[model samples]
Target: MTEFALDAPVLVRPYTARRDGDFAVIGDDSRQVYLSIPAEGLDLLEWLRDGATVGEAVRRFEATHAASPDADAFLQALADEGFLAPAGAHDPPPDAEPARARRAGHLEWLSPHAARRLLSRPVLAVCGVVVGVAVAMAVDRPGLVPGPSSLMFHSHFWAYLLVVLGIAVIGVWLHELAHVVGARAAGTSARMTVGNQMYAIVAQTDLSGMWMASKRERFVAVLVGPLVDVIGAALLFITLWLNDVGVLGLPEPVRLVVAGVLFTSFIRLLWQTFLFLRTDFYYLITTALDTRSLMADTGAFLRNLVRRVLRRRLIDQSGVGRGEMRTIRIYAVVWVLGRVVALAVLFTATIPLLWFYLVRVVGFFRGDEMTGQFTWADVLALAMLSFLLDGGGTLMWLRSLRRSSRLRRRAPDRVLVE
Candidate 1:
């Protein structure tokens, strides 16, 4: 990118702007790249687009806005982003290539507008119907949901587990797809790819464009993934009810397997409610409240509190805007409460169950014959469960600790600008 003199005028390439709540979403329509800008920034862009020199635009912006604009930095940023062209550059090519994500590669297979027009209303209706049916079934049956005893080691225990695992894999793939579908239904571009989340490799649906969407659209986009699981769970529960009430007689093994799968769906739905983890419901809440960065800002507020308690230099919090400050504080309390509940469950329930199974397996291996309802299959199941639960998590914590130490040494408690 060549540097431009303040006196030299540059052409502001054609773009589109739409109001998104408090901010404005500006997009280089030809490139399909979008960015959110403050009102003052939009004004500055308009001034530049109207043939004002950088210096003159800055003067005009300062006259209307309180702060003096950083004309040089702003212009350079625009030039780098391919939004500006030299005085007579013939508009540079209309499709000069939008900025792309380098991390997880993706392909947008569906046209957002087309998909929204086709699926939004119908899908929403289906979701509503499913929820209503699920509630009615639950009310009638009263004991429809599966329990731990629902899992039984029959003759085909391994086969059942393998099949259930396959269903779980399909469910996860559908989860990511649901996000893409939902985003498209809300008229936002979305793409799918594999990515890391909290050290686990998983499928990700990139909904970066949702920032420009309406609040209702954003809420729908976030709710759809969990709604997918909800619908699945509802259908499964209905099946269970039919089987139990003799309306449809399924084989005992078949019924058990369906129950197991239904249980998986229920767990996935429950996990979505863990807002501290930034699950679907968490995104919905943030969108509803119009918070800029709920999780990140809340964590920052908590970190600043700790620093204050320690009488140490606080992290820079200037990036958190006035509108977001109150939300962040409220979210901080919720975050803390959620963490406490999670830790308590982990220690009191999950750890104890894991320990019981692990101890039984270990004792059997140490010259103690398996007894007390424990079998070889039990050992295998417990071992696999432990591997799934603790395998990468412990290692991730160690790696994170090491990275945190290094970051602290380089810049202790510095708040990063996101």
Candidate 2:
């Protein structure tokens, strides 16, 4: 541990700070980390950023609160994390560019300025009306919604692959684009990137700047991803309804493709509902409630609960801000229940499907089944399903576990919040 020099000028690196209820959310873009601190801590950090010496800062703190702060440990932690530097040092460079520029498929030609203009009041009004009408029309038409039989229909294996992959690609592209547009609409900037989310690679929108935006702005930004999904699903339902009523003459293959799109939309919407996964809904809820550290706080609460039960040394919970405690307690129970239910569903529904398909794949190869009913297409589909649900998933999980193990080994003294 380096001792702090009273005369040395220490300054905080550049960070974006915003008020969240009674706390401040300070984002260190250089390190891709966000820290929440009480008002007193924020004041101390502000003084440090203004080139305050250790002795001067401590004197100010004591003068303000009539008691001295533990400036040594706190300042050391900031210095260790690269958030503090010598007064004459240049601004630290960010580890990653939050806003990335890339070709957004057909929307590549759409400039940021154009996106903002296109999502303006009149356009938004028209969209709202269209969405409202589509929802109303889709309500009485249950066939507009896809079913398991529709998804399981025996189509050409290549066609199935093309349809699912195409819909997923386009859908994901649109989903992330919607997030960017939403942020821009809120007068903030956002960027798109592809990264590993949980088990799979997926598109992501970096809306870290939303911390500085108003609550309504943050809500709009977070809500748009799921809104885009629902609107997409609704429009697909309308198209299916139109096809069913013969109002729009369409080929059988095209109808099937449309059905596939609707099916994908439903699945996407359902996935977004899993708040336990820190999905879009999770951000929406947390932002709405002004809870800055829901996940971390909840995990801490749970660990302390278990420690208490075991009569072991427990981490103090008093450090958590007052506004966050209730939300963390509620979210902790929900998180536990969600994990249990997810595991239950995995074993009961997913594992059985994977095993059934795997057995069929084997039976297709064996002469005992006579391969008459099960064609090569069936075998191919079953094999792909098994690979995705069993092999691919297992590999991803193992990779994540190994990565976590390495991190833990490298930083044995570090404590993981969750």
Candidate 3:
């Protein structure tokens, strides 16, 4: 394991200022630190860089300045956040060169191909229409076919549930496929990874080569999945309409399957488009802002700000240019504010839904009611599965956020500014 030391000198880099009074540091490995501070806080950073230890820095400041005497605590805090990793720990790891070499020739699966042939555009369009008609028929003719008898229910419910779950899984796979296809159409190479225990898969396209491409191409890549989703929904809707009108004559089970597939696919597409969830919308925002790593950089800035505030030391102002600083300040404010709002919304809405589900599960366990209308065994199974799915998704999102943050912190200044 790599361990950072505590006694290394603080590495002070060049400085720049933002319109909103935030400071930026340009350092080795192209790291940029955005410092939010009051006017007088700037001098404190300069004093510390002049070879002052946490205790000595504080004593020197107290000799003249009137801030709190918690400078030692503050310096320790910075050291923890990697902003001031102990001096000798800065070298690259021994395995880094080997890892780079191994990764150099990796082949990405989602490379550009003749997608128009593989997808069979006409078949997709027609099948989409058929699925829509089936859904319409099911909704309009509800209970036209009787519910399963008690014996049939006990015998076949498990099987039916498995089929439904299987369809759901397929919907997710198709969702990812759409992304891969879109990236390929945009002439980017992508690879899919079964991340975090097979619950979530990510289709990552190597668009580094396309950075110089026109904005239209970039936007097209982002828009592809959502557009395919819309097409699927419309087709499903049409199929439902046709079935209701007695034109397609689809069976009841087929209709329900179509409806379920359509509903799940459409919702997943909508979820991915939600900007707050940091889905495809998040990527779109980053591309539009021309900042490859805004959220990560903003998070780093906030972490640094919190460190300085805890230490009661002056904030550092240095390194970034004026326009870059302004952009970062705006991004930091928005990121902090958005997270607060997101937490509030999740608490108010998501928590209630979760509580309701829990109540149903408990009721089933007590045999008071047929919670979720599932057997106790099935209920336990579903609960465990859902817990794994939801929890895994959340963890993956958080990890991605952290990885993106670290990448931003270590990225070239040009990448951030662009």
Candidate 4:
């Protein structure tokens, strides 16, 4: 790409426009790009579209507003965001393509109107009441609270693993479906796939398109999944309570299966709290803070802080504002502390769990019969469960690095920009 003179005409891509508070949003429905900018930025774009040079637009902006804009910063930002290009540059670079994900587009029948009806105030109120009552009862009945040991209520380990896994699969579908509903209500769509966090397997929903929606809609879309999880858990608890009180006569096996679902849902809720692990809450935080490159900026903040202490060369924060940088400074503490806690859990709990199953399986292979309370069924189930989660998840995590490499090579799934 050849550099052009500042006096040459600029090209602003054709974009649909809307007013969002103090910002003007210009984007296309084709998923080309979306930009949220100050109101005057729209004027700048219009001027450029009318064949004005960068210099002329800058002067016009100052004259109209009685304040000078950051000409270089403004142009650089536009260029980087694919809004502006040099004279006669009609085509984007072959490598500069949008990263498209395969969308299953599940629940196509649930139109925007249907999603709104499902998420209406009445429905939400009923859900809230159910959850509130469930919580009140669980506070009194300590048995309702699930723990790691709650995973095995059945005598047969295979029954336990199978039911728990089936429940988990359904939970993932429901969770991602909630996100899709939220997206539809916000006048868009999303997709879900089996994805992995840095160290664990997960159900990932691509709400990348929701960046164009209002903050309220984005909040609804991201937070609604957890909300649905809570509702599901509440229903499970209430059903169990009914059985306990003899209002319903659920058999032992059926009751235990419901408890497994409750436990999986509980773990899913807890997983969202690890915001540093690229969970939904992380998306909410980034959206709220108006961060374009939060993880990247946080890394830079930590790197520069260490350099300042060591009297070494510092790195640029890459266009982060002072206010945003300050927030990043505070969040950096939370990020580091969260990671430290994760490492502690890994070394203490996770590693031990891995070793426990590994050693037990080895013992059984060395002509050691399954004796005592542990049967061959128990050994097989535990070994397979541990290997699939620990071993398979680690493999997926490694494979995710390759996905990250592909991401770096393609156009970014653009987040919001101030």
Cα lDDT tens digits, model 1, 1-418, are 4566678677888877777645776766445566655667788889888998777888888789878976776666566567777677765544333365434213356666765764567867877797788788889888877876666655656667767767877887777777877777666667676543343345567777776677777877777777778778888888888888899999977888889988878777777777877677888888777665678667768888888999988777775677689888877888899878866876787667667767776776787777655467757775675656554454564576586567556556543222
Of 2 and 3, the candidate ranking higher by TM-score: 2
Each model's Cα RMSD = 5.5, 4.3, 12.4, 4.0
Pairs that collide in candidate 4 are none
lDDT of model 2, residue 10: 76
Q: Write the per-residue lDDT of candidate 4 for residues 1-418, one digit (tens) a residue.
A: 3343668887777666766655677765554366667778888889988999878888899899999887676766676656667888886433343524335565667788989888899999999999999988888786867677777554786777787788888887898889999998887767777777665777888776676778888889998999989999999998888888789999878877888888888888888888777788888888788775577667667767777898876665544568888888888988899889877876787778888888888887887766667577777787787778766776887787776666534523232221
What lDDT score is found at residue 34 in candidate 4? 63
Off by over 4 Å in 2: 65-67, 86-115, 155-158, 184-202, 355-374, 402-418
Candidates 1 and 4, the one with greater TM-score: 4
Steric clashes per prediction: 0, 0, 13, 0
Query: Which candidate should be chosen as best, given lDDT against the real structure?
Result: 4
* Models sorted by lDDT, best on top: 4, 1, 2, 3
| Candidate 3 backbone overlaps, count | 13
User: Which window of 10 residues has the lowest lDDT sum in candidate 2?
Assistant: 95-104
Provide the global lDDT of candidate 1 against the true structure: 0.71
After superposition, which runs of candidate 3 have C-alpha atoms over 4 Å from their true positions? Answer: 1-165, 185-187, 196-214, 311-334, 341-372, 394-418
lDDT of each: 0.71, 0.70, 0.52, 0.76
Give residue 279's lDDT in candidate 4 (0 to 100). 85
Report the C-alpha lDDT of model 3 over 1-418, residue by residue, as the tens digit: 2342334455544443322224222222223223333333445556556765545555566777676554444444344333343344564343221111112212345445664344556755775676566466557765432232311334345555556567767655565566566556555444444554112334333333334334665676666666666666656656666676788999977776566556666566656754533466777876676554565456556666776777744324343446656777877766667667766755675455456657767777677756445666665655655555554555776786676567655542213322
Measured against the true structure, the TM-scores of the candidates, in listed sequence, are 0.76, 0.83, 0.53, 0.83
Judged by lDDT against the true structure, how good is candidate 3? 0.52
After superposition, candidate 4 runs with Cα above 4 Å error:
16-39, 67-77, 94-98, 101-105, 139-142, 286-293, 309-315, 318-322, 355-368, 399-418
